[model samples]
Target: MDLGKSQRVTRSEIDHILTNRRWSLFDVSVLPSFDTGSDHRLIRASISLNKKNFERDTHRPAPHKIPTFKSADLEPAIESNTWTLFEDLTEDYDHLVGAPLKCADASRHSQPTTIPTLNDRAFAFLEKRKAVKLDPNAKHLEKVITG
Candidate 1:
């Protein structure tokens, strides 16, 4: 690895490639001819990433509306009391988020279906778009999408 000796630089073998054990390595070589205005030569490696991350779903997620902060009602509530207000808020929040998630048992036969999600609405819009694209009838596109 006498890389930089031709350019009057000190000869050193400091350049090395750190790789994962899961990846399959084919070759690792130094390209000494390709100068990059530096003493160190270009270290090249050919390897295949054998990661499970590559097998994941690559589909774009459906967009949904995010709830904005409502500070008008909450402003005066903070002034009344801190501890009691927080406790009441926590109770209300729990009832809002935790009600539909109750587990099934002997008394409860099965869990209730969740409220219609924004994801479903977005997918419906996507289906309408696909329908409009496939069907060439411009005049009846609205009818096709809706019906």
Candidate 2:
């Protein structure tokens, strides 16, 4: 972090805690009382029936390769064909529509509605093959999905 710039710098490294063994994670039990003098709680991981459970709390955190925001070079057809939705970006509704409206000016020549109409939704669903909240009797399945 450079103090001259007055900007806080942060970095993250994916430290590999697991070995390349035949065992896989079955269940994780966090031991809160067992203190190792660190902010992190001791996690007792249980593997398959063949393997034994162990606490990797004693082992030093080995830093691995930095996880990259990777992108693959796609074909022209596939690249042009791709389409992303606005709602799926955030789980919260206020952040989705309200945040953008707050930044935008109402004095502009054209002011679009926050919520898209059914016709616009239907068109996108048919043409772009975009996922939509399509229910016959009900409107949104969010409540049902959460329940």
Candidate 3:
């Protein structure tokens, strides 16, 4: 069949059969071409059915029973009171939403701030390290080995 007049065209077709034995195929044919802006042709089929007695419980299985768990088996790692204390420490929802300035305010900056140089970053890192007091006389190797 002449599916289309395009220079580069491809044909696509599908065939299927009904699983039910009662359904019978009577006739099959390729339908007339229509201006659907597509190259694939359509197909039409005629099918007939013969009524048969269908037993409800012939091949069907019984419904499965879902397993139930006891309330004692669902103990969480953290207690409810501890969860409430953690929740209280968190910032308010409204503060979190309103914390950041709008995009328009951020884009309207008159002067751009200069980023810190590598030397400046290194100086800051060294200052922070010097501020942290370490016990020089403590047995660091022995503590790590024991742990």
Candidate 4:
């Protein structure tokens, strides 16, 4: 018997096919034929065994939890102010020089003579520096970024 898109097959159609068989429907899938501008269409059906039966009969045991660790039973670590070689040097230099100096000019001065501690001075130097923009061919999705 042919089945159309609007037609619904009853449960008897399934029972008739599995009359002598002992299989249970674990899953059912149907695939429809791709349209090539044709009136005739084809469908495929697949059936598999139920997964619950195999899982129920398995001998695998669940994991057990250990209670060795308790939040109240643990001790906290002790903190110390012991100074290392690098820490001592860094603190001493911070007190003396305050910050690292950068060269203002490449042709006139090879190295900066003074260190700048202020953020405004560092930002001013960066603002005066030249920067490259994005490539012309680069695609930007945002409307504001397109320009």
lDDT of each: 0.55, 0.43, 0.46, 0.38
TM-score of 4: 0.17
Compare candidates 2 and 3 on TM-score and give the better one.
3
Of 1 and 2, the candidate ahead on lDDT is 1
Q: Candidates 2 and 4: which is better by lDDT? A: 2
- Model 1 Cα shift for residue 68 (angstroms): 6.2
Query: How badly does each model clash, as a count of residue pairs?
Result: 0, 0, 0, 0
TM-score of each: 0.25, 0.17, 0.21, 0.17
Give the winner by lDDT: 1
Write candidate 4's Cα lDDT for 1-147 as tens digits. 344445564322222224233454434433343531234443333555557856765656644533243223222111122223345877867544422111111112223344455689767655433121244444444323432
Off by over 4 Å in 3: 1-23, 35-37, 53-147
Measure candidate 3: CA RMSD. Answer: 27.7
* Steric clash pairs (candidate 4): none
Tens digits of per-residue lDDT for model 2, 32-114: 63333345555667655432233453355644543232123223323443244556556455455654443332222342434
Q: What lDDT tens digits, residue by residue, belong to model 1 across residues 64-114?
A: 544333355344444443333235877967754543332111123333344
lDDT of 4: 0.38
Candidate 2, residue 112: lDDT: 45
